[model samples]
Target: MATTYRPPRLIIIPGLHDSGPAHWQSWLQSQFRDARRVQQRDFSQPELQRWADRIASTVDHAGPGEWLAVAHSFGTLALARYLDEHADTPIRQALLVAPAEPDKFGLAELLPQQRLRIPCTLIASQNDPWMTPHSAQRWARRWGASYSNLGRVGHINSESGFGPFPLAKRWVEVALARAAREQRPLHASFREWSFAI
Candidate 1:
């Protein structure tokens, strides 16, 4: 017999300015009816604590089933902080793309210093101004997340011409398949799974 794979509830978490209509995150939300973006009260200048709180509350309200958190740029830091604080969070997997350097905005001290327990994939660009490719890879290792390097993709945003990133959608599918196979709580080393795009 064959098994059906029901896609997890997607929680779209955009970066500093929030994904505009032309952003890939916005296009992703439109593609999936069940997916929704976590709204932040202030997008102009986000405070770490506030963003973390909002992400936590949104995940909590989504109830129990599987949840796939799609976070980009600074939103990745917010998600990391939430995971660090709440050990038993409901998120099953996460696709963290173009994570902005927390240290750049003086937020390094506020974020978690340890590895995340959830299965996560960190997609980064070689020439992202917010974070260097080396730093992004290091952070992924520190967080126990699988890393993918998209060479010179310029932060992987709308300005980089990523309004409809089909590659990201494919990666999401891969993450979901891995989650289904693992079944148990994720706590494995992800370094061995690193790849390039």
Candidate 2:
């Protein structure tokens, strides 16, 4: 008997204050019925440990399937922490966008210093107030993720006019399609584009 293939499930991790209905994360979730967004009890207070715990809990209860995470801003840091702590995580690939500076929250020492185990893509903007493009690139190197510069998009949020981000949708679709075709764990880079700044 041939075994059936199960596609990777998407786990959406929004940033501080949560992604509003008009935010790209919301739009992404609306597009995928299998996607689940992480819900923090107190979005106002960004306690790293608490946020990481929320991610773990979500993953633990997410049932059986491979996971692909899409995280933004502070949520990106939380997802990194979760990945670092859990070496046996079900997550195969991740797309981190506009990650907030770890030093800003005094979390530089708390996060993993080595490259992450799984494949990842880190997206940064030239004019994001939360993190500089240089800092984003450095972190991407540390995380062993491919870095992509969006150029001058402020934080890549709704206020930055990123409603229904088609690029993000494309990234997810490509990843899913590749995994479905291969019928194995994704060990390849998902970098669609990268530019020197």
Candidate 3:
């Protein structure tokens, strides 16, 4: 019998003020049935600790399975904080887009200072006001994530006309393929054992 492949569940972590109906993150959620957003208590004036806790708890409740996290703006910082503090996380891959400058929000101290173990891709715009391209590159290097430049697009958010971003969808598909490839060894071993019987 052929084995069916199951893609990792997607966890959408939106930025401050939350992703509205027009945001790509929200649109992506609508496309994927298993996708869910981490609900933060206060979206207007976000508290770092609270955001981190919410993210951690949501991931924990997702049980033991692969997870792909899509985090935007300040949500990237919160996801990083949760991953840095917890040794074990279900997240296998992360798509961090248009991350805000930690220093600008006085969150440099709260954000993770160390590199993350999870495979991540950081997509940033050249003209985002929240973070310069150079700063975005630096943060991607620090986090040991692959960096992609989105040209002169501003923030790559709803204002940037990314309500239903095709590029973002392609990136998610790529991540899913990569994650499946990485897990192939385990599946191969099981197949070998079954064939030996």
Candidate 4:
């Protein structure tokens, strides 16, 4: 049977400094045409409220199919906050990567963020200079997402040397396939004539 596919809406939320050209998020966006970065007020000064608002708006505006949220650094925490605060939306899955330490990073207020029903996965590195493995695991527990502890891969950003993550693509593909399966069937609701299956 021929399959119907809706290219997943990819929301890439970058943390503290916002992803530079060399960051993995930027690389992913260039690789996949549909991916986008959630516009932020300021990454240099890190504003949670602004980031949350932008994320929520982007999520709400999503037209169809599943939402695959990918976050790096503090972006992961921002998506977690959005998920916890809103009960409406079609975010199917999240891939949280390399979350920085809330305390050390001075984002202590966002530490106790709530969890949501969305399925998520956290990929963290053992020797990440910004965060501890144990802390990332804690984030996974609180967010109720599966955890992948990649050993000795510092931060998994371009700084740590990740240009095109083909391995990560496998995981993303599985998530997208699952989303296509669970998504509501698309219909020609406003069309006069539609192609027959």
Best by TM-score: 2
lDDT of 1 by residue, 104-179 (tens): 8898888777678787789999899999999899899999888889898898999999999887777666666665
RMSD of each: 4.2, 3.3, 6.3, 7.7
Candidate 3 colliding pairs, count: 0
Off by over 4 Å in 4: 1-7, 61-65, 106-114, 183-197
Q: Which residue runs does candidate 2 get wrong by more than 4 Å?
A: 184-197
Write one digit per residue (lDDT tens) for candidate 2, span 1-197: 97788899899999899999999999998989899999999988888989999999998898888988999999999999999999999988899999999999999998989898788899999999999999999999999889999999999999999999988888888788767756544735444332222
What's model 3's lDDT at 75?
94
C-alpha lDDT of residue 110 in model 2: 89
lDDT of each: 0.83, 0.90, 0.84, 0.74
Count clashes in each candidate, considering only residues at least 3 apart in sequence or on different chains: 0, 0, 0, 0
Cα lDDT over the full model 4: 0.74
Pairwise TM-score winner, candidates 2 and 3 = 2
Model 1 vs. true fold: TM: 0.86
The residue ranges of model 1 lying beyond 4 angstroms of the native Cα positions read: 1-7, 179-197
Clash-forming residue pairs, model 3: none
